[model samples]
Target: MMKRIALLWNVVKGDARVLWHALRQPERPVWLVPATALVALYALDPFNIAMPLAGVVDDGIIVPLLLHVMVRCLPAHMRRA
Candidate 1:
């Protein structure tokens, strides 16, 4: 129904606002994380480095590990928010 759609829209909007606020926190150093992660990921990529397990190592482990490091690099306060 229209009412259900409206409620869903409201919930999604609120969640977005919360995420926007979190991303804007002064102490977060937001851009630094992804930029560094990208560089690190590229350097450590198996194929780029001529490793034999290029696909599996890069996709299965390195990518996720880089993402986790990126998230961890964000300020604690921003993450808590």
Candidate 2:
């Protein structure tokens, strides 16, 4: 169980690093910016802000999906194995 948590943490950290790099690259794919913005908006949506329990549930499911989509939008050169 601890190993699984550690592994998941590492994966999340790696994804975050890759996304940060994509944001910094001048030649980043055009889709990246909008995708990121959409994720941010959804994460902070009024509905989420208004209902704490539902917000937690909604974010638990949706945030990772949005992050995956953003990562998938990365250019081939930026993608890690």
Candidate 3:
């Protein structure tokens, strides 16, 4: 029973390490972009602002623009051939 638990723990740790390494690689810039956007949004505090422009800029413009860019940037293999 103890050996089985140790094996399972090691397997989980190995998988986490693999994911960490993948996120660190240069080819995965998309992962970093979303995180930066989130940080910017938080710093801006769009919700508390009294103006409609803030909501429009954050939710209406930036969010959809980011989604559009992400959709276009998806790998060719992900799209129907």
Candidate 4:
């Protein structure tokens, strides 16, 4: 697991340019789709959905938004550097 995390980090650093370019595409939607899906799932669950709600908010919403902002705010050459 540690190795996987390290590998992911390296890949992200090396491919920052590509990743930023992909993210900058105007057609790409932000976290809205997943947020909507999570809301729907919560609504559909007859039992209490508090656990899933928390999970989605933390993992899905917060993490992605943070990553998106971080990527977008990075300097252009730094992305490739």
Off by over 4 Å in 3: 1-44, 47-50
In lDDT terms, how accurate is model 3?
A: 0.51
State how far residue 45 of model 2 sits from its true place (Å): 1.0
Q: How accurate is candidate 4 locally (lDDT)?
A: 0.52
Judging by TM-score, tell me the better candidate of 2 and 3: 2
Runs in model 1 deviating more than 4 A are 1-53
User: Which candidate do you rate higher for TM-score, 1 or 3?
Assistant: 1
lDDT of each: 0.56, 0.78, 0.51, 0.52
Q: Any runs in candidate 2 off by more than 4 Å, and if so which? A: 1-9
TM-score-better candidate, 3 vs 4: 3
The per-prediction tally of clashing pairs is: 0, 0, 0, 0
Worst 10 residues of 2 by lDDT: 4-13
TM-score between model 2 and native: 0.77
* Position 55, candidate 4: lDDT: 65
Candidate 3 lDDT tens digits, 50-69: 77676655554454444445
Error in Å for residue 45 of model 1:
8.4
As for TM-score, the candidate ahead, 1 or 4, is 1
Model 3: which ten-residue window has the lowest total lDDT? Answer: 72-81
What digit string (tens of lDDT, one per residue) describes model 2 on residues 1-81? 789758756766677778888888888888888888888898889997779899977886678667766777776788763
